[model samples]
Target: MEKRLTHFSSGSGCGCKIHPAKLEEILKDVRSDVQSFPNLLVGNEASDDASVLKINDEWALVQTVDFFTPIVDDPYVFGQIAAANALSDVYAMGGKPLMANALLCWPVEELPAEQASKVLEGAKSVCDKASIPLAGGHSINIKEIAFGLSVTGTVHPQKILKNTGAVVGDVLFLTKPLGTGILSTALKRGKLNENGYEALLRVATELNTIGAELVAINGVHAVTDVTGFGLYGHLIEMCKASEVSAEVYFDKVPKIAEAVQYIQEFILPDNTFRNWNSYAQFIDCPLPETFAWLNDPQTNGGLLFAVAEHAVDTLLNTFQKHGTTQFLLEPIGRILPKDEKIIYVKR
Candidate 1:
């Protein structure tokens, strides 16, 4: 009998990531020593997506690795999501992907070994689309199934973009709608509608390759992918890192229609509450329950970019040229001077 991978995905996938606050506490003692490794442009200090090493006057190397358990039932689809998620960090750093190494942890006792190959095939599909190789990887026996990739890419040393650099007047934009975690939860519970499943698949598998092009757009200042941490969680990280605040428009933020209805019924993944508890203090919302999309953890989510007011048209045109299906190309918020509230979600 064929096994359904989603059945094993209880608290797995990106939703199973270490708690953001706890992760901070664990890494707080570790600091980036620029004096010893001056070429390390972005390291552990600011929690940037990837660590960049300046290789020469004209080029830099970007490295990032991400692996997660099954978020979908198909082994191949899970591989696709993992590959896209891993590559997004490189794109976020304004780099183009070159190659990838696979990571597989499987329950050798229960599932067939062929499922593992399907997972690699799925990842390779995305890698092929990105014009990269699935060079090699390491696998281990485990009780639960997980898969992902370690992506390497290159970018101009001066062109690297971090989660920081947002100015007071910068405009914020989200490439995709919110609520992958909620929809994944619905799928695991056999409650997801066909449209919701399609939405989840498209968003999760769509590569955020546009991030690599943002370096050419003068109006764009900062770039980061919204993943397991959710929209509010990642935006707060950007604000605190850039020493700025944000004014988010609650109504303007795009979302999945099915996810919107599910939230009304309070259907959500545990990661939603975990994300909320980590950064609840920074979020200011009167109708918090109505806006619970802020805390829904995403798996292989979209890119969250901050751009200047004058460059909005350039950024939109660039996005159009890329021809990727990301929702709501308009601004969802704007950067503000440091304020009492880190994020102000206005109705």
Candidate 2:
């Protein structure tokens, strides 16, 4: 007799995305069209976080739209997670969010409209925190529940962060940990515990505002958010685009404590396999058993940054000095000159 949000979800958060390799298949032709428009600074060609269109000599417009089915049972919390996930793109590209419109889909007859209002309120609360306005959105009647934001922001034309530009000797770091996908899957299967839920909510709701701070950091090179394709998948995108390879330390990469337990217990999201299959050929995994942790898709995840070796301290100091959100910063790996393998994962 109670209403549940995840009950209507087909996939949780970014886990709902098309599998990485499959997505490449779908976008292959679309990627070739990127060169047709010279003003399109960052497009699908590089697998960057958001599309950056140059506006003038000084500025470029960063625009992205993201939506996902519920990742939490509470409508309000689900709304927060979805909005944070969508806004992450702008930050990943080193832009500050300016405004947004809502995206909602629900079964009107099955769920009360009041619940949808709660979802909008949750998204609005996050937008307000980011100092952006939620102007409007489009809604539709659908069988499954979903919500997100169409965010627009601005960045200096010269400073747009792309997946390209990660040079060799660049130290790598993930602003957050992995395992949102696994935990959200556990939640959907009714197997997740309170600790797991707390972990998921904390990571999903925290905005990746640290991205905006990176614009001032000279060391920050290529940056991308770890999302549906998992950390390795997104990192591979960065490597291929930047024409560099990586050395990811398996133990150094952070993970949610609860989610780690869930994985050890053999709880995994379907996307884990989807992600691995998408790019498994390109990686050299010395520890094959740890692949699940490495490829677990994330929801509203952290920004993965490639910082110059000399600027590593400057980058970490920025996180400490940002003084707004707390980051569980960890140096997971480093960029290497392109080798036959795109990534080499070791303990």
Measured by TM-score, the strongest candidate is 1
Q: Model 2 scores what on Cα lDDT?
A: 0.88
State the displacement of the C-alpha of residue 191, model 2, in Å, after optimal TM-score superposition.
Answer: 1.8
| lDDT (Cα, tens digit) per residue for candidate 2, span 58-129 | 989999999998888888888888899999999999999999999999899999888999999999999999
Q: How many residue pairs clash (N, CA or C atoms closer than 3 angstroms) in each of the candidate models, in the order given?
A: 0, 0
Error of 1 at 84 (Å): 0.8
Backbone clashes in model 1, listed as residue pairs = none
Error of 1 at 277 (Å): 1.0
**Over 4 Å off, model 2:** 32-36, 323-327
Q: Candidate 1 local accuracy as lDDT?
A: 0.88
For candidate 1, lDDT tens digit of each residue in 203-232?
A: 889998888889999978888889988898
Clashes of 2: 0
